[model samples]
Every structure is written in C-alpha cells, then in structure tokens.
Target: MIRLAGLAVAPWLLWPLLGAFIGLMPAPAGADDTASSPATLLPAPVAPVPPLLDRQQVDAAIGRLDGIVDAAMAKTAIPGVAVAVVYKDEILYAKGFGLREVGQPEPVDMDTVFLLASVSKPITSTILARLVGDKLFDWDDPVRGHDPSFALSDPYVTENATFADLLSHRSGLNTGAGDLLEDLGFDRETILSRLDQQPLDPFRSTYHYSNYGYTAGAVAAAKAAGEPFEDIAERVLFEPLGMSRSSYRHTDYLGHANRARIHVRVGDPAERRWEARYDRMPDAQAPAGGASGSISDLARYLRLQLRDGSFEGEPIVDAGALATTHLPHIAGRLPADPTERAGFYGLGWNVGYDDLGRVTLGHSGAFVLGTSTAILLLPGEELGIAAITNGEPIGVPEAIGSTFMDIAQHGEQTVDWLSFIGGFFAHEFAVDPAGPDYAEPPASAEPPRADDAYAGTYDNSYYGPLVVETEGGALSMKLGPADAPKRFPLTPYDGDVFTFEPIGENAAPLSAAQFRTGDDGGIASVTLEFYDRTGLGTFTRN
Candidate 1:
C-alpha cells in the first residue's frame, strides 16, 4: 500500500513521497467552476475498509510509545523532542525527550515551546475554518473581496482566485514564489505587494505550494474579521481551545521561558553536530510558518481536529467547514508510474489514505535553519500524533509520527521509518553537485574588466535597486530596500561572471552574477542566478 510523508517548505523539493497514495485528477478542459469543489475533489477509496485495530490493540501500541520515542531520539540525536498522541477525546500519550539545546541542562518537557514551521499552515487553516463558520467569509470567496492588496501577476487570477484556491496551493503562483523576497529581508506586506511581479502557472489547474499564497488567504480572512491575522487566530481557535501557550507571533515565542532554541546541523556531513541559532525569524510568513507552541498545546488542538472542530464538547467551528480542510483539494504529486497512486493536498494538510482505507491528514514543517515538526491524523480511527524537534530536519518528527501510526494500525512498525523517511529528507535537502564550481576557476579564465567599469547602480521593479560597488580590493553587491540592503562580496569566476554566496533560508552555496554589456561596451545589466527563478533577477543599469 502507498504511504505519504510530510509537506516541506523548500520550493525546489516541495513534495517527497513515502508510499503510494491517490489524488484527484484536475478537472478536464472546459469543466464548470464547480469542478474543483470539495465534493468533486475527494478521491474514492482504493479498497474496502478492513476491520480496524481494536481499542485494546491501539492501546497496546500506545503502551510502547516511550520506547519508540526513545529509540528515535537515540538514532536521530535530535537536541529536543516533544510528542503527543490523541485517541478519541483523550491525550493518550504525551512526553518530551532530550535536552532543549546542545550543552544545555534544561530538558525538553511537555511545555517547552518550539517553532511549528510549515505545520502552522494546518493551524492557519483551522482559524479560517472557524471564520467560515461565523459567516465572516467563505472558502470560495475571492481573496480580493476582503483584501484588495492581495493580488497576482495574472489579472484574471487576482480577481477570481478564492481562499480555497490559495490554501490548496492552486492559485498558480509558482512554488515558493515570494520566499526569495522573504529571504531577502522583505516584510510580509512588501512580499504580498510584489507577488504581482511573479510569473503564474495554469491558474487553478496547477498545484504550486506557495507560502505567501497561503498567507494571502489568511490575511484576507483577517481583513474580513476586521482584525489582524494573529488576533483572529487567537479569538477563533487558540483561545477557544485553551491553547494559551500557542501563538503566531515570533515575539511571543521569544518571551516564553521554556521555549526550545532552534538548532541547525553544522560541520562535516559525516560528523555534523547541532548548534543553537536564532537566524530563522519567520514573522514575515507568520501564517505560513511563524507559530510556536508546546506539545501540550498541540495535543489540545489535535483533539479539536479529531472531534470535528469541537473542544471539550463545545463546537468551536462548524463541522462541515472544518471537514473541508481534510478533503483532498488538489493533486500534490503526479507519479512517474501511471499505475502508482498519486498524492493529494487538502486545504492546509497533505491528504492521503492508509492501507486500511482510512483517511490520513498529515503535514511536516521545517525551517532549514532549524526546527522540524509533523502531525498525522487518522480521522477514521479518531487517532492522531504530533512530534516537534528543535533541530534541522532529518526526518525525526515525521519518523516519530509515522512510526506511531504504523504501530497503532498494524501492531508493529512495518518498516524502519526513520531510515526510510530520513533518507528522503536527506536527499531532498542535499546540495546539488552538478553546478559550476565557482571556487575553482577554469585554467584559462579571462580576467574581469576594471572594477570601476562594472560598478554601478542597477534596478529591477520587483527587487528594487542593486548597487554593485568596488570594496577594499574586490567587488560587492548590495540589494533590497534602500534603507537596509543586504551586501554580498563577489568573487571573480570567469570573465564577466562573478559569484557570491547568497544568504538566508533559500540561499545556495554560490550563485553566478553575469554582467552583459550594451552596444557602447558599457555594462548594461546583471542577472543573479539565485534570484532568477521567476525571471525577476535581472537588474538593468539605471
């Protein structure tokens, strides 16, 4: 049977499969507007429902939870981990393991807050669902109706795209459209405003996971509710569910005393070790990844999900509105083998069906700098598990959740989940070796022109101004808003081609900056390879 892994935020490696899973094929050509409705998007079960594991069987799996987590921690060496399992309305299991940070004595506990990363998407969807229940907005409502600032390059899409379209990654903004801007220190408003500069795919028919696209949908909901997105989330979901430790603001997470420090892997690959760092500040994409909460808080949230948006017997959101978040809305991955089942993405979750024909709702969040989190819900069994770690993603969280689900469903893990899922994460995040080695110039590399000849101020409508200037003895480029431009020192590669290491979450080790001369033999423009994903990286000399 086909199984699924978690959703990753990395644009180049968004969807990674673990097993076979079916996704609804996009509507045929000239289909009606209703073709992408939730009713029409849900995939048929692959097989008849087998007899589910009995309560005793599930409890037995829970009994082995400590051992499973312990084993996973030992294998991954994740600095900190907190896991919660919910069955029916009860938190069947909740625990923490390892130190909160390397060389620190503070042990991770149930209350230790960690960044949720992309897992925040699912939480954001929950907030929208509650808003939908209040009649503040509908999933199908055009985002522009609420927030006129939300727009895309395609006029038709900007005017017609619905909240559902954005949440399901079908608005056609290319994968990670605004992420580069976010990495370049752009604010949320600036990123959203510049989305019109991004190229589009085929509107609703294409699935391209975009963090800013998802954030745009949340922003529209906040506008409709007449409040900030964070406030709406608190009022509609967090506060109602009693998740006091949960918050979408990065500042709140910083103020918490028991929060886990985010850590990244460093040093040699074979001998890599975790180091605490505060480099990833996700406030710009708050709705997409800026969330921090304890496992105890997530357990409460999970209970509401399994209970159809009810908290402690009280209905927090309409069941129908909440259910829509779990239904397949678009095909996430098209398998190379036609016979293989494809994967689907729901409103904010990765939707798949397990071997038992039970619907599985899952999402994996990662900040390449640090933090990895995963959540898996079996709505059919009313069972779910959430795992969070304060370390760079190496599949610790996905492995933990997948292992728990496997044990619960089949009485034992069917595979070495850590190795299987971790291998995929490793491959996805692995550095590509095919690119030009900028560090080693060609033997006959031609010398660049005089520093003054290539130094000048260039401009691009989308990225603003980029200043190439001669530093002490070398060339450097500064780009961003006028007040706070990021600077990168350029190294001569070959002829007019110079290279610099781009920084931030989406940066590559090295990127080539090629300068082209006009008819007058004066440098006319420079194209930054790293920022050219959507054809917006070229800066023409002013």
Candidate 2:
C-alpha cells in the first residue's frame, strides 16, 4: 500500500490495476484519492449529464437523500460514481455519474471498481448460508471450536461464543485498529492474540457494534466452509448471479491510472480547496471493506438476493437459510454508539421498524477514505431497494426506498422512517443534548499565537506517531502519513482551559481540555472527553 499525506502523489505509481481503471493520469482524469502520486490530482471533468424528467421526479422523493449525498461528495471532492438499484426482482436503475478519473475524460461505467468496506459482511454471511445449507456448519456453532486458532484473552468467551454471536455484533469487540493490523498482512494466528483485549460479558444488555467481530467471522467462515471466503462468495453469490465484475481484490490491485481520483473537500463546497487523490490502505483488509466493482455487478447481486438466493431458476441457498439470515436475532432501540448510529442489527443486517412493527431489513457501510452503500428489504411488500453511494448519505436509503415505494405501490406517500430516527438523535444530541455543553465553551486561556505549543509530535494507542503542525496561524494534525487534520483557530475557555472550535469539534465531541495534577500538584496530561459509550482518552506530553 502507498501512503501520501494531503491526498497528493509522490513520484511513485498507485499500483497497476488502479492505473488501468483510471485510463490516464493527466489532469481532469487524475488517479489516486487525495491528489498526489505520479499522476496529477486535478483531472479534467467529464461532460455533465443533467438529471432528466424521470430523474427529477425520482429526486423529488429521494431529494433529501440526494441532497445529503451530493453535498458530502461536493464537500469531499470525489470525482465519479456508479450505482445500481433493484426493486424486488427488477433492476429499477443502473447508472453512472461523473468519471472514474478527471483527466481520462471517460465517464465511470458499469465496471469501475471501488473499495466496498464493510459491505463485505453480507457477502460473508451469504457464504456461511451456503455452508449451513450443506450441513457443513451450524450458525450457532461456537466459532472457536471450528478454528482452534481462534482464542481470546478470556478463554471462556472464546470457548463459548457462537458464530451467530459474533456475526450479529454480540461479541462485544472493538475495532482494535483491526484494519491497520490486517493491512500490514498480519496472519490469522498473530491477530487472534489480540482477541483477549476486547472482552464481552455473556449477557451484556447494551449493544456494541464491532467490525472485529466480522473479521473473526470471516476467518471462521473460511475454515468451516472448507474454502477461502472469496471463493465461497464468488461460487455462491457472484457466479450464480453473474456478478462478473465483482471481486474481493483490493482497489489497490488496480493500476494507478485506472482508479477513480478521490477528493477531500476543504469546506462543504466544490468551490473550496479540493485536495488531490490517493489510496494509502493495505490490500489485506479487503474482507472488512476492500472489494471493487461496477454498478451492473451490484445490480446483479441485488437481483440474486431479491429472488431469495435463486439464480437462473435454481436455488443456490435454500429458502430456509435465507429466512433465518433475515430473522431478527436481537431487537432493541438503535444502540447508543456516539458516531455510527444508523440502526440496529439482525444477523448481519440492520433491522428498522415502526411502532406498528413493520420490518425493513437493511445495512449501511462507510470509511473515512471512501465508499458506502444502503440497502433495505420489505418482505411484506415484496420489495427490495439497494442504494450505494460513495460517501456519507446521512440516512439516504430510507429516502430512496420511500420515494420508490410510493410510486411503485400506486403513489402513496409514507413517512421517511430514516428521517424520524435520524431526527430523534439530532434532537437528542445535536439540538437538545442533556444540557448546554458547548454553546460558548470556555475560550483558550493562552494568547492567539501561532501553532507553536501544539505543533510537535505526539503518540496514541489507536493511531501512532501523530504530528501536529502550525500553518497560517492554526493547528493541523498529521495522522501518520495519511490525511492531515484540517487546520483551525484555537481559543481560551476559563482559567487555564482552552478551546479549539473548528478542529476540536471534529476531533472528539468534548467541550474543552482541563489539566490535572500529580501528588506534587504539578502539571499532568489533559483529558479529551466525549459523550456516552464513545471513548475518552488522554495524551500526556513526552
């Protein structure tokens, strides 16, 4: 994997398959995510295709969603997009937007590759279903017993927790910087040792979303299915559905020129400073979220799911398995996680329902670098809609499905359920949190000097070797060699406290920093706090 900060390229290439996809590395068709590499960051824009009459009407229902996504894309400076839409068994929409690269001037087509991120989970689940169909393994089988290499710090948990427990996020694990570990190509044996670091109470009442849980599940699936997870996904889903372009291969496998340029927006507008493109992640984390493919492939995959895992008039996964996969294993209000609170879990999917209890099975995926998807199925309505966008959609799946279902089932408007849940949280946290937390939080007690004090090297457990620097009288954080945190002015609160309004708000949702003292009453490290369930960590100067 290549690492270039600020999304800019060095003299090195971005690898081969990506370059092939970008087609050209020239301006307007530049490859890479942030903007740097052997290729230019400012690729030429392809011809714009205005939304047509049909598109306009479709946008009307999904407009709030469309607005949220387009704003995020513009804010991020990502150049192109391709999406597939499926309603029940019908392919309602298959379209591409913008271009794969800026300079190549070729619009993104049906086969442009992208990093799938957590979307890989459903594919993993599909593979396990096939194994269940064969009686090769049961979902309730304790995962550790299947793969003896799977051990936790707590042997009891490892010895007892079943695949269903881990698959559904009941394993109570954390990210554990799992992607970074896997990116370095850590073997299964080495990585399993970290399992003890994340503990779970047998009947923990609260829900915790764990990506690491899925990684372990992926590993277990490979062992129990008697094949690699990639082979099972292709054989059971991709090949059967004719999703030819889909691959578990990393986006980095593509040559530099063939990859779509990724953009990081300075502000929430395209007119602002747009950073160049780069993809700095390791290829080994593909199981968590690294597959790439075109819209057609996604549509075909959706078609297979809509037909109850049947393709070409034959059942690839038995109907019984499919039902259990969609069954609600656990039910509660959306978990109390601070940042990623879209909905709750049903096996590998998110289960969202209303008071009268109509169920929609779905899921969403996103990563800081790029790529995302939102898909929901209404069994009673016999309708399924899958919407995959490149970045944050702020709950666009409900908007898309609501609009489509209105027109599909004879023009009836239904409440946007996503809006309700999202808004409920907005009112709770963004609008009326328990109390006025940061409405004029204390100003920094220090004078407005250059980024002198904070501009130095620091370290953390999650991401190491963090370097902060001063530029234009504001402070910016360099996270490893990847993207630098946006610079912002820092101010003083009361006493010796300080406030970093712009950048600090984004840092972690804490108000300000306060110093604590040792037994001698001397200065010690300051703590950065956040809301419930989110982590609160401290950094001491070295």
Best TM-score among the predictions, by candidate number:
1
Residue lDDT tens for model 1, 135-212: 897888889999988889889999988988998889888888888888888899999999998989998788888899
- Relative to the true structure, candidate 2 reaches a TM of 0.63
lDDT of 2 by residue, 1-542 (tens): 11222322111111101110011111111111332311111223333223222434443434343443354345334566555556446665665666665555766666666555556666667667777778776677778877887765467667776776666666656433244334333444444555564445443233455666666777787787788866777777777777776777654336534455443334543455434344534234445555655567777766666667676578887655654555444433442353222234545665443222334555555543434455555543334555554433233333344445444432334443344433432332243356336546445434433345455555444333445566565554443223343333334455435444322111233355444454665434444442112242354544
Model 1 pairs in collision:
2-20, 3-19
Number of clashing pairs, model 2?
55
lDDT values for all models: 0.81, 0.49
Q: Show where candidate 1 strays beyond 4 Å.
A: 2-51
TM-score of each: 0.92, 0.63
